[model samples]
Target: MDAFICAGMMIIGRGISRGCIGARTTCLPGWAGVASSRRRNRHRVESSARRPFGKRLERFGVEQGMALIKDEAVVLRRLDFSESSQVLAVFTRAHGQQRVIAKGVKRATRQRASVGIDLLERGDIVFSQRPGGEERLSPLTEWRQLDHYPHLRADLARYYAGLYAGEAVAMLTEAHDPHVGLFDGLRKYLADLSSDEPGLLLARFLWLLLTEIGLQPELSVCTSCRRLVTEDRVLYFSSRSGGAICRDCEPASIEKFQLSVGATKITRGGPTDARGVRAALTMLDYHITEILGRPLRAARSMHATVVKSVSGGG
Candidate 1:
């Protein structure tokens, strides 16, 4: 009887040991499950945090053949395609100047809502850089509307000035040279000129634009004899070598245009009054016409003429 009881006690202990081992094996998977759930929960929270900017980007998504990119651009000009899409010349803050095509953008519904922006309009844009191509004028994928310079379109003089502005940008900048600051200066100049004084504004604009682009004569000094341009002589402007040559040196280079002594004193980035400005402008216009090889007919017609009051010549 004693032996039987001892054997039973040993068997019961062994069974209890086996049961405990089995219970632990089963609960281990549950522990692993809890750990995995914790890891997944952490991942879920991180993923949730990442969603907004992604949604912002999706709203900003641009379609290319196999990729998408983000960019900010201002509309410089746009051309209508046969009818369905538009080709745009945009100055992207990121990519300088680019010629992009907004595919299927011209339909009445406008897959992209706005038919590329009107000239000189500002906007947020997205476009693709193709797999194989030079960065110059990267193919435009699309233009998302952000803002418009309605004043540029609504007013007549502003429209023409806007065109001249476009000419300035195209002429002065290469396709991919980023000039954010110069453009900001141009934009402010445009906005002021559009609303304030269109007449006097254009002249000042030409002077500013030419000087900014490094096309005008270095008003720093007379190009000829390297003398400080004094305020006393009639000035002759040169388009050939590109600045004023004091009269003494005028005979040497191919003669270009004449500026009154007073005009020479008005340096680049300097001030001028109506009379001084007009004389200076006439000389500047002559230089521009000569250098461009033909007349900027628009500029010619835009001249501020002193009207001989219907009765007689002034």
Candidate 2:
């Protein structure tokens, strides 16, 4: 009789666990988890990690859990989860881009978030990968805010622009891809966009992004013939063709955007042609949007919010 009851309870408990506990944790959330099978695998990893559990995970290169060390990082973005905890997108100066799950960050504000949960937040972060877990990207074991750049959040336009910059970085940048110049440009542009003129700052940022990605226009001379871009009657831009086309090279696909001789003189922006930054920005904008097939929301937002985008420089 005793054995029968124990066996019955085991069967019933297994059924209940399968029916209830099995649903929410269908998969482990990692790398933007959105599938059922991945979620189920996540569930198995989490449920089996207990005292009685005996299976050992494969100790592959990333398996020794060396990935779970305290790292200094900059907060990129944060998203609230459906239940508890917060999802964090971070860029580490040391390791590059990664996702850190800051568990138990939903109900109460997390102390660790003060370190790198928002714009310009930087600090020491504790991260780890568990053998089996119900979440993707692994739960962040610990975190504490070290520093925050107040300038990033002080201005709305600058703040939004920072987000736009972050998105651009997120979309184009591959995981673990490290380019020191791009990061530096982002930091400087974020800090400067607040106190600096909108057009000039945006122009500089786009130019840097283009140059960093090696997509920058061939403006030093005629893109086709390498002849110096002298005062020409009209200028045409085509996404399929790339950059300003000479009169002979202009294709039917290329639509003309009027460029002033003043605007055309803008080869680069530093000390020399500081006055023509806006012109350069407009030129860059035409090229970027022409290629991307859409205008940057931040740029359009600036035009709407400022009431007047005074003609001059970025």
Candidate 3:
């Protein structure tokens, strides 16, 4: 009996010691656990510190009720907002057209002159916007200039053409509606503007923009009667009628422009020459003007400059 009681007491003591150890482990982790937790937290801090600005903002923006966006963009327009700030209309490849205000972008310092953001410059941009405030302007947090297209600045004709392209994008596209093809085409056009014939390049870009936005005018058939248009017949393009109109349909179209065989052929994927390209460009410009209910300002300036250049050469 004495031996059995001693054995029971030993078992009870073991249970009590284990209970205390388990409670301590559960309720209060010791120095090792605390050190391990500290190490994990430090790792997280270092990882976050090494992240890019946009990524860091993305994480913080989620908690702060804002969205962070990063994209390649071209500055279409710029307006001075204050002594040290400016407002811009930028067309981004992924996010479409955005109006953003750049705070303190024009502030002069000892290191650099405050020229501010210029119109028609391409760059990589980082910006932020509120979740429900899309209509309001976004804040442009960071801008790294990619290409200024200095050649365009040197030539009056090229500069006006660039302005025309930028203005068209600003007017035709809706905000926040992405057009990746159009953005790519614009970049290509601007890059080639220094070498390629300005009129031809502009015409191609305009057609691309029109097609991207689903406003391309039909060129193969009579828009009114849906009759197949033969190559030899006279063709008139009517923006209101939505494409090429036959002689019979021409009178009914309130707005019509006569198209030469060469112009029609060029517009229909045929070989292009100087005169044909100009004709096609004029037709497209007319259609765009009708759609916008006003003449494009840059286009008008560009045409005048072209005419003067021609006359002066002559």
List of clashing residue pairs for candidate 1: 100-140, 233-261, 235-259
Query: Residue 227 of candidate 1: its Cα lDDT?
Result: 78
* lDDT string, candidate 2, 1-314, tens digits: 00000111122223223223221121121211111132456665345434231122221112344345556666777777646556787776555667776644343221111222455566666565555542457556445555565665666656665665666565555555666777777767766765776555666676777777777776656566656666545655444555666666665444656554445554456322444554565676567666667766555655443213434323
Residue 133 shift from truth in candidate 3, angstroms: 1.0
Name the better of 1 and 2 by TM-score. 1
Per-candidate RMSD, Å: 21.5, 12.8, 18.7
State the C-alpha lDDT per candidate: 0.53, 0.52, 0.71
- In model 1, the Cα lDDT at residue 197 comes to 50
lDDT of 3 by residue, 1-314 (tens): 00000111122223222123221121111112212232446565445446553444442222245666889999998999999778999999999999997766676544345677789888878777888788988877567678888889888878888898899999999999999999999999899988866766777788889889999888888999999887689899888888899999899887898986555654555326655666676787888998899988887886765423331222
Ordered list by lDDT, greatest first: 3, 1, 2
Q: Which of 1 and 3 is ahead in TM-score?
A: 3
Total backbone clashes of candidate 2, pairs 3 or more residues apart or in separate chains: 11
- Show model 3 residue runs off by greater than 4 Å: 1-63, 269-271, 306-314
Sort by TM-score, best first. 3, 1, 2
Off by over 4 Å in 1: 1-69, 110-116, 135-139, 199-208, 260-270, 283-291, 304-314
Model 2: weakest 10-residue lDDT segment is 1-10
